[model samples]
Target: MEPPVNTIKLSQTAKDQLLKLRRHTKIDQWNILCRWGFCRSLAEASIPSPVPIPADSNVELTWKVFGGEMSDILILALKQRCHNDKLGTDKETLAHQFRLHLHRGIGYLAGDPNIKKIEDLIAIATKK
Candidate 1:
C-alpha cells in the first residue's frame, strides 16, 4: 500500500532552507535532510499554525524516497501526533499535519545556530 503522503512538495523557502541545512550538515540527500527537519519540528511542543506551502520549486519526492524503510513507523507517529493535537484521526488531517511538521522542522534546522555540525544534532538530542 502507498503511504498516505505519497508526495512532498516543499515551499520555495523550505527548499532554500533545506539547501542551507545540507551545506552545513554535509548531508547531501534530500530525504535524509528532510527526516532531520521533520523530526526536529515534531520534537517541539507547540502546534504549527496552518500555513500554505506553495509548491513553487521543483523539489518533490515520493513517500518511499522520503520516509524510506521507516515509512510505516513515521506514519504511525504522525497519526499519534494528530490524535494528540486534536487534529482528527482522518487521513487528510494527518497529511496536513505531516506537511506542517516537515516545514517547521526544516525551519528549525535552518534557523538553529548551534547546529554547525552533525555532532550538534546529537548534542541537542541528548540535552535535557
Candidate 2:
C-alpha cells in the first residue's frame, strides 16, 4: 500500500523533544523513536487535536525510513484508527491525522517523568 505521505517532517519542538528522548534512551535513530511515539499516540483513547504543526525543523524522513520494516502494518494501523474515529481514510485525512498523532505521541513520551531510560519505554509497552 502507498503511504499517506512520502516524507515526514517534524516540527522544531518535536525535534528538540526527540533529542531529549535520544539522550534519555541512548537511542540514536530518529525513526525508531518516532515509531514508538506514533504507536504511543495510537494507543491513546482520545484523538489528537487537529492543530497546525509547522514543519520548521530540518529533521525529515521518508515514510519508508519512518516505518521501517513495518511500513505496511503502520499504514494499516493509521487507516484503522481513522476508521475507528469515524474519519475518512482518504489521503488527506490520513496524512493529517498521522501528523497529529505523531506529534502528540512524541509530546506524551517526552513529558513522561517515568521515561528516563530505554527500559522505561519498554515498561510502557509491557504494562498491562
Candidate 3:
C-alpha cells in the first residue's frame, strides 16, 4: 500500500517565500517542496517532516519550513552566480540558483551517485 500523502506544512513567512519562488520560477510548490525534502535529507542527513498546520486543530495541513541544508545550497549557488556576475539581479540570480538546486535535488531524490559530484558537472557545463 502506498503511504499517505503528508500535507506539506509551511509557516506564513516560508509559505510566502515558497509562493514567491514558485511565481517567479513557474515551478509548482508541491514539486519544489518534494525537491527540498530530498536535498535536505541527502545533503544534511536529516529527515524533514512537516509540523502541524495552524488553521484548525484537527487539520494537519501546512508544514513549517525549517532545516537549513537546502537553503544553504541555494545561498551558495547564488553567491557563486553573483560573484561572477552571471546574473544581473538578485531575482534572476535566485531563479537560476533554484534551477541548479533542482538539478542536484532531482539527482539526490533519484539516488544517483552523480548527485554527490554535481559541482564538477556544473563546472564543466558552465565552462565557456
Candidate 4:
C-alpha cells in the first residue's frame, strides 16, 4: 500500500495544545508526540468527533518524520482503520484521515484529566 502523504499540517490551536502536551509530557519533539497522538486516536473504540480543524500552522512533517521507524506500520494501521470505518482507501481519503486521527489524538492527549506528567501517560497505557 502507498504510504500516507507528507502534507499533514496542524492547526494553530493544535500547535498550541501540542505545546502544552510537550510541557506536560516533557517530550521535546513534535513528531514523537504526534506519533503518540495518532496511535491514541486510532485505539479509540469510536470514530473521532467530526470537528474539522483548520490547517493554519506552518509546522509540517513528512511521513518519515511522523512515523519514524514505524512509518510503514503506521500506514498499514491507518489503511486498516480506514477500511474498518468504511472509508475509501484512496490516497486522498488516507490523507484526510491522517489529519483527522492526528488532531483527535492530540486533543485526546491534551484533554485527558489524568495525564498530568510523563508517568501519567504510562498509567493510561497500563490502565484496564
Model 3 C-alpha lDDT per residue in residues 1-128, reported as the tens digit of each score: 11112243333444444444444345564444445533433353222222332322221232222213444554454455445544453555444433344334433433433333335334433556
CA deviation > 4 Å runs, candidate 3 = 1-5, 45-128
Clashing pairs in 4: none
- Candidate 1 Cα misplacement greater than 4 A, ranges: none
Q: Considering every candidate listed, which one attains the maximal lDDT?
A: 2
| C-alpha TM-scores of all predictions | 0.94, 0.99, 0.29, 0.92
Candidate 2: minimum summed lDDT over ten consecutive residues — where?
A: 43-52
Better structure of 2 and 3 per lDDT = 2
Count of steric clashes across candidates, in order: 0, 0, 3, 0
Two-way TM-score contest, 1 vs 2, winner: 2
RMSD of candidate 2 to the truth, in angstroms, is 0.4
Models ranked on lDDT: 2, 4, 1, 3
- Order of quality (TM-score): 2, 1, 4, 3
TM-score of structure candidate 3 = 0.29
What's every prediction's RMSD, in angstroms?
1.2, 0.4, 15.3, 1.4
Please give, for residues 72-95, the per-residue lDDT of candidate 4 as tens digits.
899999999999999989998888
Clashes of 2: 0
lDDT of each: 0.86, 0.98, 0.39, 0.87
- Cα deviation in Å at residue 29, candidate 2? 0.2
